[model samples]
Target: MCKKGNEVDKDLHSLQLKNFMGLLVPHQRQIHAFILYLVVNRADADDILQETLVEMWNKFNEYKDGTNFVAWGLTIAKFKVLQFIQKSKNYRFHFDPQLLELLEHEAIRKNGVHTHNERVEILKECVSKLQTKEKVMLDLRYEKNLTFEGISRQFGVSVPAIYKALGRTHARLAQCIKLTLEQRGVA
Candidate 1:
């Protein structure tokens, strides 16, 4: 009877883990985005995200079914971000606790509605608006994966010129993307 009971417990544990993954896999992106928005450092945010996932899994049995998984995950992420901020003494610029709370609230409010795909599509359009010379330079640097020295050689200009043109192009692209997002009521 004890052996049978142990087998049943094992089966139940396996089922719960499977169910947890089913929910977690879909919401991982949202959770990562929330952490990224708050932490602002990709490496730290990624580490926090992994910690959040492990913490969530450990507490999975406490999670009630039919509740909002994303909300639960985001709540864990928010706590993890707080813990990270607290532990990193050399950060130089720490957010006030109240300000961090407010940002977390705002991130939750804007979570799923943040359209990454739409932004990528808009960025493509903005890139297309660049001048022919600008486009060629961008392609050479980005698509062909050439060094700045290589790009300067190809363009027959100084390295600083290439850097200046790329910087201006980046600023223009950023402005264009922002304006387009605003126009579409998505910003």
Candidate 2:
């Protein structure tokens, strides 16, 4: 019950999946080692490896036939490692200054693209110095992407209070990032 083009597409999909699996199976160990190097912990590296493989499987359809499979797979693995580091409980970001500079350069090289890694680190340091409630409020707003209404509902606080808290947090974070960047001669 399929047209000719549909049958051809189905066959192509099957071939792509098979090829991707073939590539991944052979490179699994290398992939794991690369992820481990980035994460620097055995358990976290294992979790990231599993997540990366699952993501690659789910996104296999997006891979172009006859393209560089290893590069694409490594890209997915890198993204998973970054996400794991960002969300980990005992998170300690240890990126070198040169790597940070490279990332910043890449962000600027991309048209209309933006990243806040340096600013986020400075904000994290400053927020760690904040009172618990203020830190929690800021995290809920920015990190969690919760709207004022949603945060208000969750915390049973007034929307205005949430707004005020966020405003104050934003001001403090801005000042902190400015100071940090200035101290590092990067601003």
Candidate 3:
């Protein structure tokens, strides 16, 4: 009974992760851009974006369906930006705190986030550029929702091998997407 309960909990967590990723990926670039705008440093923006994503995932149960994912994410991102700013004594802001607050409120009110169809197209192209094995790995893990252990068993490899391969593939795709976005003057 304990084993069965553990299995059920694992399955539930997996489902929640899948659902969260489905909602998160499409808005990821937008959230990053917002962070960049607030922080004014690519490295700082990246760190804040990571923090914001973790917070969003942690509080995902509070998110409502059929609502504004970008707006919700931006609220979290704004808080993260402020938190980071407060923490970093060396960081300097071009605008005052009042202006920053106004910008955040106005952005939310205007719903300035735009859908990145071009990003989707670029991502598809990038995925197509991957090697056959890499493509299959991504499909199995993401599209087929296979865990690392499951993928390893299917591919006759160790779980760490599968994990490393997926990590490398993810990094490659992220670089590809970012480069493509820059080339298109979208980033």
Candidate 4:
């Protein structure tokens, strides 16, 4: 009976972790960007994101299952950022501690549990509705991760022409997305 109970407990923990991850994935980019805003160095920001993820995982049990995991994660990230700052006094950061705190609070306010899924839906629709040429350009630039020059070569166009097309496409997509979001009343 004791051994069976232990297995059940372990299984329950695993299930809870899966649930936590479902909640965590949506806000991951925002979390990393928050860390980057504080640390300012790409490498150091990446390290802090790793550390924050580990800490969040380790302390997963302390979290209430349906609560705001982004907020909780950001709290942990803030501490990690502070620790890094403390340890790296010799290193110069873009903002001092006070500025970081203000930025963190403001960022959290701006990005807190946004209409992420809705935005993704809107973006997909916008992309799909693109003119054929613009859609191909987007795929080349984004999906293939090609540079303007590379895209130009593939499309048999000048780099400047490619750049102009990409810019126009981006602006059109942005407008479409904004209109879609407004229609959805996501303000």
- Cα lDDT tens digits, model 4, 123-179, are 899889899989889888889999888998898989999989989998998899878
- For residue 157, what is the lDDT in candidate 4? 83
Per-residue accuracy of model 3 over 67-92 as CA lDDT, tens digit each: 98888999899999888888885756
In the predicted model 1, the residue pairs found to clash are none
Tens digit per residue, CA lDDT, model 2, 1-187: 6569989999988987788788887667657766766666778879999999999999987888778776677789888877775676475654654674465344334212222455557777887877888878877876998989999999998999888878887787778877777887776
Where is the poorest 10-residue window by lDDT in model 3? 106-115
Model 2 bad stretches (over 4 Å):
1-16, 93-187
Q: TM-score per candidate, in order? A: 0.67, 0.43, 0.56, 0.63
- Per-candidate RMSD, Å: 4.7, 15.5, 12.7, 4.6
Candidate 1 Cα RMSD after full superposition onto the native fold (Å): 4.7
Q: Which candidate is the best by TM-score?
A: 1
Clashing pairs in 2: none
- Model 2's lDDT to the true fold? 0.74
Instruction: Please report the candidate that would top lDDT against the real structure.
Output: 1
Q: Each model's C-alpha lDDT? A: 0.86, 0.74, 0.83, 0.84
Displacement of the residue 32 alpha carbon in candidate 2, Å: 1.0
